[model samples]
Target chain A: MATLMDRVITSKAAVLEGSRAIAEAVRLCRPQVISAYPITPQTHVVEALAQMVADGALKAEFVNVESEHSAASVVLGASATGARVYTASSSQGIALMSEVLFNIAGLRLPVVLTCANRALSSPLNIWNDQQDSLSVRDAGWVQLYVEDNQEAVDTHLQAYAIAEDRRVLLPTMVCADGFLLTHTYEPVIVPTQEEVDAFLPPYRPQHYLTPDKPLTMGAFADPEYYMESRYLLDRALERSQAVIEDAAQRFNRAFGRHYGGLLDTLHMEGARTAVVAMGSVVATLRDVVSGLRDDGHAVGLVKVRSFRPFPKDALRSALRDVDRVLVLERALSPGGVGILAAEVRAVLQGQPRQPAVSAFVAGLGGRDIPVETLQALIARAQDEAVEQGFADLKAELVEEGDEDES
Target chain B: MKTRVEPAPELLSPGHTACRGCGLLVAARLALQAAGPRVIVANATGCLEITTSKFPQSSWNVPWIHSLFENTAAVASGVEAALKALGRQAEARVIAQAGDGGTADIGLQSLSGMLERGHDVLYICYDNEAYMNTGIQRSSLTPLGARTSTTPPGALSWGEVRTKKDMPAIAAAHGIPYVATASIAYPPDLVKKVKRALGIRGPKYLQVHSSCPLGWGHDSSLSIRVARLAVQTGLYPLYEVINGQLTNVKRLSYRSPVAAYLKPQRRFEHLFKPGGEALLAQVQALANANAAKYGFPPVTEGAEAEDSD
Candidate 1:
C-alpha cells in the first residue's frame, strides 16, 4: 500500500448509468470529503458514492449535509485544508450552492462538483436542462459540459486533474444532462488504480491552511487591494485553458479516450450549415447532422464542451467554414434569445468571416425534442436563418388571450 | 479545578485596528492564546476578519481563513474533516469564530449544521450583541430594550423588544460533546473554556460575551467592566454543558441588579428616561428569571461599583 498509496485496477468497459460512472471516477480520485444534498438527477450520483464509502470500496469522509449551502461549505473548508473533495448537486440545489461556488473559486480551492444538469423551479420542475449551471457562467468556475456517459466519466477524471493543477487552481463543475445522461445506462470505461495513479497524481494542494505554517487566507481587502485579487483570479482562470487542454491530451494518450480540447467539432469543413449545442444535445446534433449529410445537405455539428471559458477561439475557428449556424439551446435567458446562441454570436464577433447565426430554444424543463424537431431546425436554418427562434414551443399551451392583442 | 492564567506570549499582537478597549479582540486574544499556535481559525466576515488581515498584513500567527459571513462553522467543519482525512487531526485544531450576528442569526443554520455533523471544530461566537461590523444593526442575540441602528428607540417603540435568543442552549440542543458560555471580563475562565473545548474530540461551542464600546454606547475603557456586569446580572451566565449535561457553572457571588449593567451603556439609556422605566423593569425581570434558571448559590450582595479606568 505504501509503494504508491494505491495499485491501479485495469479499467473495464461495463454498462453503467452516467451517475454511477461519475461516482466511479470520483472513487478513483480518492476524495477526502463527500458532502451533498439529494436533488433529482444529482441524487443518484451522490447515493452511489455514499454506498461506495459504506462498502469500504472508497475510504473517505462522506458527510451528508442538510442543504446544498452547507454541502458546498463543507467541501470549501476541506479543500482549504488541502483535502481532495467532491460534491454533487443540480437545479435548485446548484442554485442554492451558487454562493459557495463563488467562494470556492474565489478562494482558489481545487474542489470538484458533479452537476447532473436539471432545470430551475417554479413552476417547479425536476427534469434535465442546462439553465442551472449556465446561469452561473460568470461565477469563475471551470464548467465542462459533456456529450454522453463515456465522455462524462472521462471528463470527471480530467476535472480533478485540471482543477488541482497548480496553474488552474479553480473549482470545476462536470455537467452531464439530467435524466438524459444521468439515468440512461451506457457502456463506460472504469480505469484501473494503476492507470489513474499514472494519469492523475496525488493532489498536492498549492495553498492550504496548516497550523504549523500559519497564514491568513480569504483576508478582507479594502478598496486598495480588492480589484487586484479579483484580477489575479480572472488571470488564473484565463490561463486554465492551456492546463485543461494539456490534461485532456495527457489523459487521451494514457487511457485511449480523446476529449478534443475545450470544444470538439464534427465535419465543419466545407459545410454551409452547422448545428451548435452543448451537453447531450451535442451528441444528438452529431447523429442528426451525419444523416443530413447523406441527404445532400452541407451540414456540420459544433459540440461546445467548455461553457465557462466559452472557448472563443476554438468556436470561432470551428464555425469559420459554415454559412448558416443553427444554435440549439436547451435553456432560454427569459426575455432574451438562446443562451448558447447568444454566447456563440458574441464570440464569433469580429472574426473576418462568420456564419449567420440562428437561435432555437427548446428541450426546456425536460420537454422532449425528437429527431424531427432537429430536422425542422436544420431546414429553418438552411432557408431563413434568424436569431431568437423558438422550436416546438407548444403554441396551444398558450391561450390566445394569454397575450394582449394591440 | 480553577483555571489560572498560564505563562504565554501574546497571540493577537498589538497594532490591530479594533476600537481601543473593545473586549471582542480581548476575547479573541484569550481564546487564540489558549489554543496556542496549533489551531487554525475559520473566521466569518465580521469585526475580527475586517480588523485583521488587510491584504499584505495579518495579525494572525496561525493558519486562518475567512470564507463568508454565515458559513464559518461549515468552513471549519471542512477544515476539521480535511485534517482527519490527511491523518493529521491530532496535529492541529480547527476553530470557527464569528460575531454575534454571524452566530445567533444569519449564521445559525451553518453553525447548527456544523454542530449536528459532529465535526471536530471549536466554534467561538464573540457575542458583542448586535451586528457591530455593520454599524450596530439589530441581531437576534441583541437583548431586549437595547438600542441599535435598526432597532432605535422611538415614541411608539422600545429598542429590540424581543428577548435575547439563547444561543448556548441552542448549541447544547445539538447534543454535541461540549457547549459552554464564557465572558471576556473573566479572561482566565474564558481561556480555560477555550482550552477545555479544544481538548474535546468532537464539536464544541464557546460563546464569549465580548463587549463593543462603540455599539454598546459605553466608554471604551469600561468594556471589561460592562462584560462583568452582564454575567453578574445573570443576563449572560458563565457555565458549561459536557456530553449533554450541565457539568460546570461559574456561580455568581450575588445577582447584580440589571440597572447597574444597563445604566452604563447608551443602548439602554432610553430606560433611564421617564417613559423607559417600565421597559427597564421588564429587563430586570428577565435577569431575575435567568438567575432562577441557573440557580447559583447567592453570596455577598451590593459590591462597590469600582471605576477601574
Candidate 2:
C-alpha cells in the first residue's frame, strides 16, 4: 500500500541561489506576516520576500524593521496574534536579536527564524561560519543547519511544520551558511503552494493573544514555578523529536526529497570509520568520504542537520556499528573547543557500542573548508587521534608578538 | 468635556497588588476605560505587570502578556502587525505599556521601531521619573537634582545630574498620528486622550505622568496632589500633537511654583536646603521655560483655581 509517507509529489525545477530558494519556500508556506531586517547574506532572503510582497505573489505584511531585534520582536508579536510569521537574519543581527530569541522560544511562540549562519565580528568578517547560531544553541530553540541550497529549501518547508506542531510549539532556527549556500547558485526544486499545503497544514496555535478570550502569556513565575516552566520546556523539546521525524517523513513523501530525521548519513555501508559534521562543512566532508570510499577506505559520513534536541537515539543507532567517529566543527567556544563536536560527544556518550570520538574544529571565520582540507585532516587523524583539536590551523597566525609597530 | 459619564466597564478589577496611592494603577484603569474590551496589552516588566499578574491570579480582564522590560513596544508592534495580517486590525487594538525607564531608556529603540513601522499600536508610557520596580533606580526621565537609589545626594553632588527625558517629544519625532502627555490627576483629560489615540489609525504615543509615592518619598495620600502639581507647575505639560501639529493644549487655570511640587517629596528635599537653593531655582526655571514654550495662559492675580477641587 502506497501510504502518504510513500507517495511523491513532483516540483518545478529552477536554478536559484540558496537565499531565493528559502524565500520561495517561505512564500509557499503562505506566511501572513514577515518581519524583515537586512544583514549581509541574509539580506537577499528578505529582499526576495519583499519583492514577492511587492509583486503580489505573496500575501503578507513585509515589515521593514529598523534592526534585527525589532524584526524578531515583530515576528514574535505577529506569531502571538496567531498569524503565521517568518523572518531571516545573520551574524550581528542574530546577536542583536538574542534577547528576543530566548523570549520567543520561552514563550513557545512558533516563529520561524531563517538564520543565515555567519561569523561574529571583532575584526569584522562577512563570511560563512556557524558561531552566531551555535552561540544561541541553549536558547531553547530548534536549531537546524542545512548542508546545501536544496536542503536549505526543503528544511525551511519542514521547519514550519515541526515548529507549529501543537506538541512542539517552539521557534525553529533554520540556519544555512552565510555566503557559501546563501550566495551560491544551484538547481533547486520549487514546490507549488498546493503541494506544500498538502504537506504542511495551516498553523493553528493553542495559545495566543486575541480579543475573544482574555489570557496572559509570558508572565514571570516565582522561583517556586520557574523550574517547573523550564522543565516543561525541556520536555517539550525532547518530545519534539517525534514530530520532527514525522514532519520530515511527510515532507519527503510529499516532495521527492529526503532530509534524514535530525541527521543524514552518506555511504554508511559496512564502514568501520565515520565522520560527523553540520552545515556546509558536511558537504565537503561527504565529498572527501566518497572519494576515499572509491579508493577502498572503510569510511562514512553522518550529517547533523538538527543541532538541538541532539537526535541521540537516531545518532546512536546510526553509529552503533562504527569503531571510530571524527567530529568536525565550524564553531569554537572561544576558551573551549568545538561547539558541535562537544555536543556530538555528549550524544554518543553511554552507548553500549560506543565509537572512539575525536573532535576537530575547522572553518572559523569562513576559512574555506574544501574537500582537500577534509582529506588532509583524515590522513592526519589516521596516525594520531585529534581529541578536541583544531583542524588545519594556521601556525603563523597564532604565534604571539609577530606584529611590528610601524 | 463629556459630563457625568460612568467609567467604561472595568477591565482591571479591584484587589490589584499596587502600593497605596500608586498613580500608575489609576492611569491603567483609565486607559482600560478608554481602550475598552477589544484590546491586547503587551505589558513590559514593571510594577504594573508584576502587581497585576502574579502567579495564578491576573488582575487584567483583557488579553495581556508581560514580556521583558525592554520589548513591550516591539511585542505590541508584532501584535498590531499580526492583526493587520489576520484581517482584524481594526476590530482589535494593540497597546504597549511600559514604565519611564523602560520607555525612555532601555526600551527607547523598540519604541522608536514600533512608531517608525507605524503598526497601528497605542503605546502608553507610565512615567514615574524613576525605576520603581527595581527599588527606585534613577531613570532618564528622572528630573535633574532628584534623588534615587542610583542617584543619591552626596557631599559634592545634587542627585540625578540629567534632566527629565522629553519622551513625548521623542515619540512625536516619529511623526506618528498622535503623541500626547497626560497626567493621572486629570482622569477625564487623560482618559479622553487615550480614547482619542485609540480612535486614530497608525502609531499613537501617550506618556502619562504617574506619581510613585514610595519612589518620590511622599505621603501615599499626596499621590494625586503630586500628579496634579506636576502639570499645574508646568513640569509636566498636558498637550496633544495630532499628525505633528500642536492640536490641543490644556491651558493652566492656575500655575503653581515648582517649590509646591518639590517640597513635599524627599527625593527633592535636598533642593530646599540653603546650599541647594540654586538647584531649586533651576527646576523652577525649567517649569517657566515649559510655560513660555507652550504659551500657557497666565492666571489673574486674585483668581481662585478653577481646578482646585
Highest DockQ against the true fold, candidate: 1
Residues B1-309, candidate 2: write the lDDT tens digits.
Answer: 454436577899888799999999999998898889999999999999989887778888898987788878888888887888888876688899999999999999989988987778899999999999999999999999999999999998899987887788889998888999998888888878988999898999999999999999999999988888888888888899999998688888678788888888999999988799889888978988988999765533443233642
Error of 1 at B296 (Å): 4.6
* Candidate 2, residue B89: how far the Cα is off, in Å: 2.1
The superposed Cα distance between candidate 1 and the true structure at residue A52, in angstroms, equals: 1.0
Worst 10 residues of 1 chain A by lDDT: A1-10
Superposition error at A244 for model 2 (Å): 1.1
Q: Chain A TM-score for model 2, please?
A: 0.94
Candidate 2 lDDT for residue A311:
87
- A73, model 1: CA deviation in Å? 0.8
TM-score of each: 0.95, 0.95
Candidate 1, A90-129: lDDT as tens digits = 9999999899898888889989998899999888899988
Model 1 residue runs over 4 Å out of place are A1-12, A400-406, B1-4, B296-309
On residues B1-309, what C-alpha lDDT tens digit does candidate 1 reach at each position? Answer: 555688787767778788998888999989999999888889999999888878888888889999888988888888888888889887788899999999999899999988998888999999999999889999999999999999998988889999989898899999999999988988888877888899988899999999899999999989989999888887888889999898677776567778889989999999999888899889888878877888854423564264221
Candidate 2 — which pairs collide?
none
